[model samples]
Target: MSQKKMLRFSTGALLLLLPWFGGLVLGEISNDFSQCLDFFYNTTPPVGITAAGYQPICQRYKNQYHFASLYNRQSRSPLYSAYVLSPADGKRPRSTWMFEPQLAFSRASSEMQRFQTPLDQNVIESQAVLEDYKNSNFTKGHLNPSQHQKTVEDRKATFTLTNIVPQKAGSNSGPWNGLESEVLNRFKAFCNGSMHVITGAMPYESEPRWINNRVSVPEYMWSAYCCPSYRSDLPEFLKPFFPTYAAVGRNDRNSGEEIVPVNAKAGASVRGYDVRRMSLEALEGILKQRLGMPITLFHGQCQ
Candidate 1:
């Protein structure tokens, strides 16, 4: 939370750009998330959000569909990425950042492609490129983090840039990461079936922040999950998180302490990047206030 400029650090090793799954790629974005409907509960996307420049992406990679991202064409960041919670299978994949090629050129390959040298003028103009995060003092935070996935391919597919946001090192590696780990444990413990999760970024209402004046830096990060089929025998404290639960974490340590209060006792590295857990209804209410839309994360409130 210091006023001084955030120190620069290596985000990751930009290893060789990997190959895309040549066979099963979903062509350019469409009007809806129909291609990746399996990722959503009841096969429905969030309701009440306006339809504008937001593009629906069926994130395809390595011959498989991993998740769905609702990308903002203008801000060059994803509003949300929806996917089914699955158990971790292996170590995190190498950080070979990729891009949804079809987002830039419709006739281009349907699969997400690894960034090449010099970059394409159309690709840079259409979406976020690796250059945006280089020395930008921010990390490429995954909205649909790879840790909450089932297979190696599923985890690697999350490396696509369309599903990332500009997040501070404190937030991305601090409380926000803890929350993701906790959710994965919860899924392993109680959920008997699919746990549909939607993780997203919330922009500041009054002022928006950006990295390299391109990708938007979220003021807060939010997530919600729907697990209709859960163990019937649940402890009292665990009941609330059975069918649904949600949380909002601070991406900016300097942000106000209203939505997520800072843990003064915590280490300085993660001091202000606190996370607040709440009910699905509470999260929806907050989303409505900040987004200026009546947001419903799941159908029938995931009943």
Candidate 2:
């Protein structure tokens, strides 16, 4: 064939295969979704797992005796806390932590998809029903720190379903959020690598609230610990960001009482707390049974 004819034939073939090739590439990337947390469910494997599957990075551990809350509520679920003890990567201690590595949380939005069970979506979506539970008092809490996962990709990963709970706005975005930022900043200042962090939500008091057909109630508060600190490759100017943080549940709007226990563990020369250890399978089971419905995940500020 003439050179011109050969070139034309090659172009035609490429165009013909473009759809298949493009789809394959897209699938491959989507399949690479690996960072995930698990919950418990009676079903063998919970819903919304990626094609890559879910894996456990933390161990199941709890310590109500020594644990502190970022926010406090007069709810049974408020005091209970859980964490994952991630492997120390040479920089951080192998202490019990909450939140998982590379995980982040934000309020639900249309753009993000719900990764938990189908039941979560139904339960969480009812604004009017949940309103009584939400009460405009709580903040959509996030477990992952943005400073740790600076990149958009990693930050986006934190938006998964398993990493969120309702928190008082004063607690969620205030001191508790401040702690996450300070920890990451400190890790970045003194440590040598990326900090592996785990965060969790402590449930809060529930009013007989109903929002948009959803029985909305603040179920969890905040508790986070980090390990294997961050890279010390920070500019000196940013050093101001590394101050120590204290956890306190914010004062209640209605009662005006110091509801949250700020500095809950202050002046305590304690080394660390024990963590709950569970496999990915076990976590998934819990998520399925507990969450039960699908819930949306996202990043950034949301009302």
Candidate 3:
């Protein structure tokens, strides 16, 4: 064939394959949650958590990317919500209290929106809706808190139900809240670059706890952060906190103290459900013991 004829044939074949290739690319984007991890500073998500029923969510609100969460449909809550800590200023945004529509409805897209009242009765049965929290003692505690976000839109995106767990009133309002505030201040003061954070829950070892038998109630709440880059000049007190730090907060007063010792000094309000700060390795050790599985929260253990 002539050179001109050969070039024309090649161009025609390329055009014919474009639509099929586009469809393939779209299919991969729609199906996998790991695709969203590109938003992370190092494109690293936590490892070693149970994979069963795990769903990855790239949180978007008002058409803006906010964060990513590893959601558990079986528990109707997030296993962990990961986000980069931004410089927070001004008042925290009001909680919009959204639910993941795509989680409950197959036809629904991964994009997030507010939960509809009189939820489509068909899909409502499969997941926990807002009504489950009504009259319940547990508060809708955030796994990825709004305070860590910088912008109003980013803060509001954290309100999705997939990122919430059934947290106890005392833990949510008292010690846990204090821990979150402390973390925020630490990140603001020391972290000079991107701060990667993952906050999650731990369920009971032997038996599963539930709210309205719909959402699984976590026995303890845990969080960890990796600040790969930070100020080299460090105060003596803040030295141990560099690179990585972690904590495990008690969610149930009735639970034993093998992992986190109860604080006698905390007084009546927040005595039992105390938050214990520890080295990242210590927290991972406790998780491994209780979860009966080897779990790593950061890549190379954030080293």
Candidate 4:
């Protein structure tokens, strides 16, 4: 039978044996991907080497860099995830950013060697491609952080233009940042299992430029991360807020139109993409086919 037929048959059979097979499938796919940490990390061949047009949602780029995402919506914005991540260093032997992962992860693998940082300002700016803005009040923001790199050199490399967005200071450093940290902390406390987080900022019409880059990139940028395993500790006070951890801007200066607050009981959605109900395999399939690359997992351990 064809792959499609085979997949269908297997899925049906699994459904009978495993009622939660759907959840398992989704988990497997999601676990296969890593968050979109950098524009140039462990990307597959030509996709890594080529610069393609910008995609609004988490789309695929050159098959290698698949935008595995939790949500996609017309009203909200697009989000992206990475297919692979490795060391990224230009030809310069003096550069330490390329190998910074070594310091961040206690156990670094040789494959991480392929990861390189966006060294040239011109090149970094080109990849980020900041665009026009709609509401001056809103700023482009990064969902994935370069700061995840702990080492001084690795952290600095994340400052590359490719990993930036035009975001309001209040959102960037204030409530938005707090929300990310809170969610991460809560995830560790609750699930006792790893969770993947993909986030993106919705773009308006006008695109703004960052300081000193001499170029403009997306008005809003998205960042995503995954922790397939979580800690088992529990806290009663924190349980109420745990479910909505992935939601953005729980606390912010009310623009009246920009931020959306989510309720854990009712749940929330981004654009049309259901933030709570997306499978990584489905996400990967879409990205891989869209970018025209073979099946290459981007996020999590595979990254």
Candidate 5:
């Protein structure tokens, strides 16, 4: 079956099972944002990565589905953002940098206009406001990069602050960006099926780091992709990448290399922010150790 057809079938099955799956009504929630999970396959989101005060966000813009985010209220940043890859259209939209109203107000009372403005009395003052990133050393890094999506709208939908995290300039423009491009190129060339990608953050072990004491800074950034259908005749270098692959990139240069080791050849600018590619199982092992619990990013390891 084609990837498009498989997506349709999965969505249909979700709708059919929605009524009996849980007492929760799909569209009955007053907030339109509540329907965000409808974008996920079978309406099943990632599991085992959430922490206390973390909220799930189904990112929608202009009534179009974009991506899903697991946001940390305390950290005032996303734990991760999940989205499906689409063929690139070569048109990048300017970042509008919007906020999530539901993060500040009750879902029923949250207004669309709230997404455009900064909240004055938000419970989590650490919430990353646009002003916080201004003149700061770090860049507003995107977990679900705009380049992975196809349409203009899809690209723009990724601009919301809810889907962003603090990243160093070296990592954002260097090794990390290279990894995202590599994934896009591989999917466009070899994947004959849908690719579900989840990119996220790993916090420091003992003490938490902060960006201006507002948004929490991640110690490392990690990503994984699951492509169940692909050309069997992959090159030797690309063989282990099929079905599922994962990577972890250093976010802090001063941090220890017990997780992702720094690449000495990456140049002084990005030497410590090197990204390491590994298997799906290896990524999960790191997550399990850091989170103090077993966390699964994809269903059946994207079998």
Candidate 6:
């Protein structure tokens, strides 16, 4: 074909495909972390995850950034959410779940917004929404659990679907939840300065799993923390846990017993969903294997 004819054909094909993969276009949640870098250990994101699928989101709510979420639009989930572990008072807020409007419209708004009645088609296509979890046999798991936030608004900001992944109920309310509580206990007991925590999901190796054909379900839930400063007089047992800590929880009962082994002695409700605590290096090695790249969760390994 002639050069002009080939150019015309290519342009036409692209125009037709635009609507099919409209959500792939990055709207407004941008590369800039200038708005909320304090959430990271040294105001630096984890190194080595340089794939196009991941986008940095400074989760803003009510005019302030409460945390940061490294979102994966293709997976319709967060790679991880980072925040300082603050004392959560009162109860889980009953606020409506929200989404990043910029994900749908480039100039819509920087702040997260609540899903509208019959949520906009663009919004629904751009990211996971409330309907994706309705009766999907999976729970909307929060990477940055509200219990770790300090204020009501900070806690409520975590309800955004961008920071969520489809997690099994067995894990959400079982071993994983227990791990969250344990981390809080540790923070309250020893951490003197800011205790930064990063929680994320791990996908199955062989094949992808999805809920509502829109959201990817995680195979394991992992978390790690860094406390730069703590009490000088530490107990013997807590020595190894100081400076940094890490863990991985089984999200699927049928999953292989390689990363996180199942506890046969556990109650029937949470049989295979056991969480295994490990060192920072151990967790990073696993992440490197799973993500096919090196990872540095905390700066200088929380030195």
Q: Give the root-mean-square deviation of each candidate in angstroms.
A: 10.7, 16.4, 9.0, 18.6, 12.0, 7.2
Candidate 3 or 5, higher lDDT? Answer: 3
Q: Compared with the true structure, what per-residue lDDT tens digits does model 3 show for residues 245-274?
A: 999999999889998889887779787889
What does candidate 5's lDDT look like per residue over 39-67, in tens digits? Answer: 44445666674457777776756655578
Ranking by lDDT: 6, 1, 3, 5, 4, 2
Deviation in angstroms for 18 in model 2?
A: 20
Q: Candidates' TM-scores? A: 0.91, 0.37, 0.86, 0.38, 0.84, 0.90
Clashing pairs in 5: none
Alpha-carbon lDDT, every model: 0.87, 0.32, 0.79, 0.35, 0.78, 0.88
Clashes of 1: 0
Name the better of 3 and 4 by TM-score: 3
lDDT of 5 at 291: 75
Q: Give the lDDT of residue 293 in candidate 6.
A: 77
- Model 2, range 1-303, lDDT digits (tens) per residue? 999999999999878544323211122111221312221111112235232222332211121111111112122112222222222233322221122211221221212232322233332332111233344544444454333443343344333323334555555555555565555545544655322233443223434332223323443333323233333565876443322111323323333233332343532321111122232233334333444533212111000
- Model 6 clash tally? 0
Q: For model 4, how many clashes?
A: 49
Regions more than 4 Å wrong, model 4: 1-52, 55-125, 128-141, 187-195, 205-228, 236-244, 250-255, 258-303
Q: Candidate 3 regions off by >4 Å?
A: 1-31, 39-41
Model 2: residues with Cα > 4 Å off, grouped in runs: 1-137, 160-162, 205-220, 228-303
Query: Once superposed on the true structure, which residue ranges of model 6 sit more than 4 Å away at CA?
Result: 1-28
**Which ten residues in a row are the worst by lDDT in model 4?**
22-31
